[model samples]
Target: MMTNILIVDDDIHILNLLTIHLSKDGYQVFQAKDGVEALDLLQEKSCQLAVVDVMMPYLDGFELTKKIREQYNIPVILLTAKNQIEDKEQGYAAGTDDYLVKPFEPKELSFRIKALLRRYDSRADDSVVRIGHTTIDKKSYEVQTGSRTILLPLKEFELLYFLMSNPLQVFSRDRLIEQVWGFDFSGDERTVDVHIKRIRERFSTLTDDFQIKTVRGVGYSLEAKRS
Candidate 1:
C-alpha cells in the first residue's frame, strides 16, 4: 500500500515543496491550510502520518495534534519555526510523535517520517501486550482491564506500554525518554517521572495484576504481581 501523508500548514510554499518532494519519494500527499481543514480532510481520507505546522490561522499544530491523538492512531510530526526548548516541550506534551524546526531539509523530514512509520508499523504487527488481566493495545492505543477500557493520552500510553512490554526489567529515565520520546527529546529526566506518576494515578485503582515499581536512584520497572 502506498503511504498517505497529510501536511498541514498555512504556508503555500511549504505545502508545495513538501508535496513535490514527498510525491517524488513515492508518498501520496494531502495538504490542508489549517487544523480545521486538516480535520475535515481526515474525516474523508485515511492517512498513515501527519506533518503539522505550528502557526496556522484557524487552529494551531498543538491543538490539531491533540485532536488527532483523541481520534486517530497515526503518528504526527510537528513543524515549528521556533527552536526553543519550551516550544518543543509543548509540542511533545500536545502528543506530537516527532518535531522539526522550520527551514529544515526535506530529506531530514523524510527520514523522520520513515522512522516513525517503521516504528508504528512494527508495533502494529503484534501490538497487544498483557500483564495479568490488564491489556495494552498499541494498534488502538488503548488499555483494558476486565470490562473497563482506558484511553490515555499518547505519551502516557506509550510510556505505560513500554514498561509493561519489558516487565521486571529496570530502565532509567534517560533510557525511557530515548525509547519512548526519541533521541532528540530535549526534556529533562523529570519528564519521565511526571508521565510515570500519571500512569500510576490512572491505573492505581484499575487493577491488581501489576504495579510500576520505582528503583531508588535507578529507574522503574513493571512487576507482575499475579501472573
Candidate 2:
C-alpha cells in the first residue's frame, strides 16, 4: 500500500513543491490549505503522517497538531519559519513528533519523514495488547473477537487499544484526551465521548464479554461484563 501524507500550508508554492518532491519519493500526498481543512481531511481519510505549517487561518499548526495527536498515532512534523527554542518547545508541547524550520531542504524533509515513520512502525510491530476476548493487533491495526475480526478507523482503534491496555482503570476524559489522543490535545473533551460511543456501538452486537464503563464524573474504563 502507498503511504499517505498530508501537507498543510497556506502557501501555494510550498504545497506544490512538497507534492512534487514527496510524490517523486513514492508517497501519496494530500494537500490542505489550513488547519480546519487538514482536520477535515484527516477525518475523511487516513494518512501515515502529516507535515503542517504554523501560521494558518482558522487553526494554527500547534492547535492542529494537538487535535491530530488526540486521535491518530501517526507522526506530525511542524514546518515553520520560527526557529526559536521557545517556539520549538511549544511545538513539542502541542504533540508534534518533529519540527523543521522553513527554507528546509526537500531531501531533509523527506529523510525526517522516513525516519519518523520507521520508528513508529517498529514500536507497533513489537506490541500486541488484549482485553477480554478482543485482541488488538497493533501491527496490522485490527481488533479480533473470536472468529470475527474488524478493522477500525485510526482514532477508534487507538482509543480502544488504550482503554483495553489498562483494563478496569478509569481514565478521565481529560486524561484520555491527553494520553490517548495527545498531551497537547486542545479540543473539547467531548471528542473522547464520541470515540468511546463508537467503540461501544462496534462491539454491541459482536460481543458480550467486554464493555466500556462510564465513570460519570471521571471517564471510561474497559472491563469484563458482569454475569
- Write model 2 residue lDDT over 29-136, tens digit each, in one string: 999999999999999988999999999999999999989987788999999897899989789778788999999999999999999999888666656776557688
Q: How many backbone collisions does model 2 have?
A: 2
TM-score of 2: 0.60
- Candidates' lDDT values, in order? 0.92, 0.89
State how far residue 135 of model 2 sits from its true place (Å). 18
TM-score of each: 0.65, 0.60
- After superposing candidate 2 on the true structure, give the runs of residues whose Cα lies further than 4 Å from its correct spot: 128-177, 180-227
Q: What lDDT tens digits, residue by residue, belong to model 1 across residues 47-126? A: 99999999999899999998997788899999999999999988987778999998999999999999999989876776
Candidate 2: Cα lDDT at 158: 86
Weakest 10 consecutive residues, lDDT, candidate 2? 123-132
Backbone clash numbers for all candidates listed: 0, 2
